[model samples]
Target: MAPKPTSSIRSFASSDRFLAEIATDARRPGYVLAGDESFLYQRCRAGVLAELAPPDQRDFCLHDLDLAEVPIFDVLDRAQTPSLMVPFQVLFVRGLKTLYGRGQKKEEFAAIDAYFRRPNPSALIIFVADHLSIPTDLRRMDMQDKERFERIRETLGDWCGIVELSRVDEGDAARWLAAEAVTRNTQIHPDAARELVDALGADMMLIASEFEKLALYAQGKQLFLIPPQHDQAQPVADIPTPTITLGDVETMVLAAKQRSLYELTDAISAKDRPRALALLHGLLNASDGGEDSAIGHLYMLARTFRQMLIILEKNVRDSRAIWSVLWHGFRMPPFAAEDLIRQARRYKSRADLTRALRLIARADLEIRSSPPDKRLVLERLILALASEPKPAASGSFHQFAIDL
Candidate 1:
């Protein structure tokens, strides 16, 4: 008998159930898609469009609006007014945070309440609440995010359905990667699945994008391995299946390139400012999006710092122990295990690693604020991270003298 499958292979119930509702035409007047998981959000969007707005009818039926540009009253008016060209309409509204901005906007909530009370039968609205981040374990949610989610529940939950698009668990991501490869007539080794998910920090959007490239790479490998025979009559036996291995994942995925990221961290941990700056430039130059990819770089940096923090806290001395300390999806690649442990040990204390994380977080905020020179912002961040913290004076408090 075949071995029992792991429970981690289960489908994404939240989005899948929402899709089922769409298919059965049991959707509410509006829905609040709560979370920043882009992969699930896209899946939900595709399902809605496929069911309500077919290709031919999309021109007349689909409306994409942002609250920053359009007011809630205008959106309601458009929803209420029947379209002569189409029988059904779908509206996707972004920038939902604008609604809950400063001041108690009783009028907006009242308007939303009134519209849902007597909603149009032919219209559907999807409010994207991506400003918040919901982790796989809801109990560990950020305090501020918990408050925001509660406010949303108290307000939007009353009328519109709330569909959460939380972060995909590492196990689920690995299973999904394996299952997805089967659909393309390819096989992904279990090790490869784990490596891919862990290397990309279990960010589903990146995993999906990189998986496509790996699939194509695997196809090319198969073509090269089994050369086309000139005689059509002869059939070859024992053909090897096209499979993606852990090596392939490390080779193709940019983040999986251990040398690129680990080397940068090595320099940072050693306080090699010049080398760190050079490595940063090399990373930016190699990426398809030079300055624009600053956020991605910062994410990897923050993740690495967090991993190091855990390593220090646990006193992980070897590669084997590192695995147990860092959970699935958050672990570094095997080749970098020793390197990372060494780097983590270079830190004097947990406070130093947390300080590094705070600097990275600040850089992330500066990048998102639309800085005129993103490269300069990253350079400043690197310089601060690579510099040694000044010793505290007798009277002064102990703190890292961050220039940025």
Candidate 2:
């Protein structure tokens, strides 16, 4: 049997692992860095460039091209050329969609696909998608684009490794913040890290930038970087600094900014009326988009409750099983998978979630219809969602089974 096309693609969650793979493997000629998330892709590209050439040699060894501006033939020419100052020439191509996106340049793509078969070993050719050309949900991509996406995937699947550099989820983002803090010679309390992640919502670039600012804040307060003690047990005598408290995180990272609407979703799931109200108020008052923001919250809440309804109706118990199904079907944040399962129990039947969806749809319509007091309408909806425990006149749904 012919090998499965996906078998050759490698996905990496850790920046360390991805960088290490490219650094250690000198023979891998090309990589397709897919996904719309630019921050992760940039980091991976930076690692490859750093490995391929030093700053001084980059002028001579690195070639950057955007398919939108330059032709594929030009890109191929650059990739084929060897570096004069370094062992490897780095060829970076951005906007892979220009080639594969609608208005198919069959001849150009055919040439590029052929090159992937035997790319120049002396140059690292990387094709990157800076933003979602095709839908992040591949199923949402039109049949034409989906076929184009699959063709590209299969063509480069064996010849070049495919790296999906997408955003990390809430849990992974929190863990990354903590790990990054350690690297910066600082410490973040678990709660503080979680707060940062919740407020930021997995924008890795923003999270990293905030960490730099936090490091300075800690240093200025003299709360980080304890003095070395020669008498300490180990030869390395530097003492650990104090942990960054949640308060510090709130003051530094959040700075009274409106929390993400995701918190409101959690609040509604947990049925915390007061918290949900407060979050809704903050989102309405502080969020920039006003009515648009309100609609976004409704959409998110509706979508989340709908997913929970599925889990409840199916009575999916094991976390692994739930995640496996959700991973392929819906894109829930991995960190919140367990939370969703737990919250599913609050629903007595599918009717509750279905009613909630109706309420959200109603709210969306009201906002669009130009209500005199839009916030008032949303607040009332929140109260109703908080107060209602189960759907009225509902069909039977399997009870959520809690493991002992």
Indicate which candidate wins on lDDT: 1
List per-prediction Cα lDDT, in the order shown. 0.86, 0.68
What are the per-residue Cα lDDT tens digits for candidate 2 across 1-404?
Answer: 11111211222254445566676754478777766665666677777766677888888888888999999988897787665667878888886777766776778868776777767888888777555443333445557545655776776677777675545656766766676677667888888888777666566677778878877887677633444444445443454574677767766664224334556767887779999899888777655546776687677777788778878887977565685456554646545666778878777777677777777787789988988888898998887777654432345454421211
RMSD (Cα, Å) for all candidates, in order, is 10.7, 11.5
Runs of candidate 1 with Cα error greater than 4 angstroms are 1-11, 230-237, 259-404
Worst 10 residues of 2 by lDDT: 1-10
Residue 399 miss distance in model 2 (angstroms): 53
Tell me the deviation in Å of residue 337 in model 2: 18
Candidate 1: which pairs clash? none
Residue-by-residue lDDT tens digits, candidate 1, 1-404:
11122234443778877777766657788899999999888888888887889899999999999999999999999999899999999999999999989989899989999999999999999999999999898998889999998999999998888998999989999888887887798999999898888877788999999999999998888766554663547654666778999889877887677568899999999999999999988887766544458898999999999999999999999996887788978988666889999999999898789889989999999999988889999999989999887565556565654444
Candidate 2, 278: how far from true, in Å? 12
Worst 10 residues of 1 by lDDT: 1-10
Shift of residue 375 alpha carbon in model 1, Å: 27
